[model samples]
Target: MSPKSLCFTVLVAVFSVLASRVVINPTPQVLKYVVDFGLTISSSPSIVAMFIPFDFDDLRRHHKNPDKGKPVSVCEDFPPNFPPPETNTTLTLCVDRNGCCNFTTVQAAVDAVPNLSIKRTVIWINSGIYYEKVIVPKTKPNITFQGQGYTSTAIAWNDTALSANGTFFSGSVQVFSTNFIAKNISFMNVAPIPHPGDVGAQAVAIRIAGDQAAFWGCGFFGAQDTLHDDRGRHYFKDCYIQGSIDFIFGNGKSLYEGCQLLSMANPVAPGSKSINGAVTAHGRASADENSGFAFVNCSVGGTGRIWLGRAWRPFSRVVFALTSMTDIIAPEGWNDFNDPTRDQSIFYGEYNCTGAGANMSGRAAYVQRLNDTQASVFLNTSYIDGDQWLLSYDT
Candidate 1:
């Protein structure tokens, strides 16, 4: 008999006996599937089958209640007994425009806290879109912004570099405090998407200049400069960020773990040479600055042809370790932004990255394929000084 017929017979006989025990094991971990040949028998196999491990528990839970959103975990930045009932020790302020909370606007709720207070304060925002520019000044420490969920709670605004505020100051939410934490929230910039013809459209969703800050389950959306990790040491986990040009640009020492970096298409212009934009523009100006961006095990994909990064400053530094990139990434993974001199200074590298886009064969000459030892430096939390703060919060 033919190989295809033999395999089909074998599968039928195997499944027929296994089906008898289905009542005992309702959900099996193994998933079996068959593949058909597309080419000639010599070039391609007539029958190929494989078994994959499927997560039945998660699948069942999701099917049970698809509408229910994931619950927000308690802030790791604060202690278990943090925010005590005492006004001096703790405060929980709610902001709901529909009269379900203390204040209607987010700023009002934030302003209610005492400046330079040592106590922990949690601002719980209800599900709604608040179109306002929110700022957490340097004075406020140990403050947490808790939202209903990323899709349910959003702080959005429209401001571009061409606006009166300028690129550096045009942020929907700007945080300059220390020991701050945000969870299940979204920071959005409603500025128009950038086009090749556009001149300077750098809008920021969130400008985080805070030290020892952590964001979890958050979303940042914009076109250019979506997230400005400007100055400080920070950590981001399970977050989604989408943009077109130099989206996640900054000088902060940051560790992005298990996050998503999505690319959007750039509008076509009369004389545009490239249709896609660069994902990062790290600004580590000098070698002395202890700042860089490390993305570990992150998912990088989306529309448009894009580069992993471009040198925003002379000593720009960035790394991607064990990340999964899509075909959208350009073969020349890193760009010098037409500045040949920057090619000598950028510390761009990748380690054990997988995917068609992660291939280093066609990458720029300056881009380094890190070895096991070199990759270890950027893969851990220590890259962002997280050893000092992250452990404390996590405990």
Candidate 2:
């Protein structure tokens, strides 16, 4: 069979099984809607179908059936008799707001896990918007937040630096525990983007102050201080991060692989002509800090003129290798954080990067155009000691 037909057949088979467990507003019209939608699923077939949100009215108008109405029970799809094994070392707790599974809130589920447990615990968050400030404290470890999909599951908040707590404490989702993994989730800070006279508008979508943490197929969205990769050895792969000012800043010895860094339009400050933003502000205070930002096989694009990075601390280090940059990047890329003295210690470099902004002619004199020998050091998993913690989730 053709690939499209094969995909449809598989989806039909999968959803047919799911339909047995789920009553999809059960009516002949609804049943016909299933058949029509199932055939349309060929384009983006996902075998993992569950309680996917569907518009009942939209379906009913398109097809007619004589079956009477009844209250739909989402729990039927997840029977208690088939509860997850109790002794299963690799536990997965489902978080459904409508009391369909184990817990209703994400924090409640996180609180249930034992601290410092050796076994990996997976918190499977359903497709919905969770408005909460989540934190995985230092005492907890080996935890994974698995979302349905990047666009489908989101955690959002509106905290800012001006809050009773400072910017350092203003993360919508802060992870301090080691060996944490977040997949297919979007972390958002809904606070207004900083503007002129906007005091303490450093809203952070997510903060990683943990070691051996990894993010895959995730998204971070905000305007200023979008992602605080605060401190640790971390890895971000196939993720999307969008912001305007110092969006991807931190002191973490981390690697961003195949990720997208989007720069929003400039937020003009008072009396400023053509205001712009910087993508990163690495804060490596000393040479012994063992922290830097590595962008490997990543892409930088979006609106507004911006600098690739600025040194938040004297010894800050950052490298962009085999990445793509758009003309949005400032010709003189790396900034010295308005401190000329930082020019002497900061290590900002790029290697084999292609795009309109990759021209070395106008790049800052201090920014290195690394040769193969130097580029090798920052282009692999070794940059974040991934050999030790990233083996299990190598995708």
Candidate 3:
């Protein structure tokens, strides 16, 4: 069968079975330095037929009720247990660059929140470009960043890793507090994208190390290391994240629902067919760490051919379920970060993803052919344990 035939069609139901066991690709070659402008694929002699898994009953039930106490809306949510008796439990601080609001910058509003307060402090940012780096310290939890709109309200900076002394400090906005939320905001790193061999080219748009954080209708713009989802259980709904190499990296156990992953890397240079860049470089360093990335009902589209994900560290785990991928995905599907040894340890899988690039014929050997029992683990809010804290979500 052709590589296209091996892929799941857009109409294919995940609950159905993939009945055939066949080696669709005769040869699999890693395309890095080779000129591959045409994105030509050569088949290889590999034994492959994989299982497609899905909990049909559970999926239907979950969709019937997506809001499970997770803070699903930006304008309609308050911290849990903020009884109506205490009017001070909910606070709204306005930030306007024009000085019409309570604060002139995003940071000032964040500073106004009392440290370690149980109340939810909402910082409403007016529509404008706020050129500054803002950090919500770990001490200040339960804060919400509410903006007029993602495109109209932006917090931007132009600090490269070299300029910031390291990638850890280069984010336009860094949040270290728990239960943080962002709505209709854009966090941007405006530094010029760097080419290969360029020193410290990484520019981070946002870094979220806080647990139980949620982002709704947010946009993250940058080149490399765009989202430092460094370590946490985070939810990103209807968000747009654009970047180049290792853009969406970090060890966060995140669920990217209905988000768009855009690539900005110049994959082909001139006549060179060489492909560069990857959508995600999940940095799960150990098997014991309950950290992984799950993209559900997301779309991957943009310039340049890149891997859906690459193993940035040993035991890196990432899965894309029911996502629509374009031809931008490289044939190899994934990379072991150029280290063959790491391949055995990484957990990479795709469950019922559809697109021209969704064919598994030329995927890496380590790609998991998940069964329903296995796929269920990463296909829904349960992957991030949203039942515990999140009040609700869209299916």
Candidate 4:
């Protein structure tokens, strides 16, 4: 071969080797900035593109590696909100406005009980309007309140945001005790109906503060703040929940099976907002998190019109599975709670939901339709698992 051709061939071989090294070893800058920020690197011309930058510290704080070998318990950690359980005692406080058990007040009966214990106790409330604010704390569990009738045995209070210091979301009938149950009762908050432009008032009717609490055939009536399924895991079966605004809003993971959600007109919105206001604002804070509210086989329709729900928090996750919705449900199905930015992170979904409102044609792109396997995770009852606990309640 000629000397010039040989020299050119050697130069081409060196260039190929250099190119191979560059492709194999990414630059230090790329490693430090691009890979650490979850960027993808392409090799045609060596390009780095960031899809989603994940913050490892934030992830570590939010999620920990699961201890797979840890034994699961029937009852997890208890909150400080429940009252001590009552045992071996049956206390009947019949507060009839004018009849037998003539105590006119419900608070008097609650006060009459001595320190609660870890035993079974029943407080039979008669048919009357007991105007009082009642609270059952974490120390008091296993307390059953049986009412004479769903509508006749009424506990009415009208505590509004103006009456207290907290916001509408804070109005709650918190139940923290375990194994607490209420049957055939009505919890109503008769707060003054909001005037034509008042937007910032809340009157909470019932708040379940206890854990392992169940309500059967109960009625929760109010314009807003109707049933504060505030915290813990609650089971409400065959119950009626009525509200106007974001009535059912909280962080508790509750299951409402075979219940009725009634909607009243928003006094402020008038003609613009329709009647049945938002149904729920579940306060879950993470995507892979377990805290949320689920409505199974429930019917969502009321006398008035309203949106099905809106995001109460940025990462709020709620699911309506196999439920029947009415025409009153808005086409959008879910709202961003008046803020458009929250739509990016919220997980509002429906599986096998049927009704005029369940149509997904108008749903936002962020709303998801979970597949069968993903949906099964929500049914598991070891906390989020589908244990036999949900079956224990008699709806």
RMSD of each: 15.5, 12.3, 16.6, 28.2
Q: Order the candidates by lDDT, highest first — what do you get?
A: 2, 1, 3, 4
> What C-alpha lDDT values do all the predictions have?
0.75, 0.76, 0.75, 0.61
Quality of model 2 by C-alpha lDDT: 0.76
Per-residue lDDT of 2-101 in model 1, one digit per residue for the tens? 5444443443443344334333222111222222223233543333222112123322343344466654222322234422355756788878654544
Count of steric clashes across candidates, in order: 0, 0, 17, 36
Q: Which candidate is the best by lDDT?
A: 2
RMSD of 2: 12.3
Q: Per-residue lDDT of 252-344 in model 2, one digit per residue for the tens?
A: 999999988887755344334353788999999998899999999988887777889999899999999999998887778878988888888
lDDT of 2 at 96: 72
TM-scores of the models, in the given order?
A: 0.76, 0.80, 0.77, 0.68
Which candidate ranks first by TM-score, i.e. highest? 2
lDDT of 3 by residue, 38-106 (tens): 212255222111111212332233334455744333222223432223246777778865455478889
Whichever of 2 and 4 has more TM-score, that candidate is 2
Error of 2 at 208 (Å): 0.8
Tens digits of per-residue lDDT for model 4 on 329-393?
Answer: 76677888778788888878788889887888887677788777766655434433335544354
**Shift of residue 103 alpha carbon in model 4, Å:** 5.5
- What ranges in model 3 sit over 4 Å off? 1-86, 267-273, 393-395
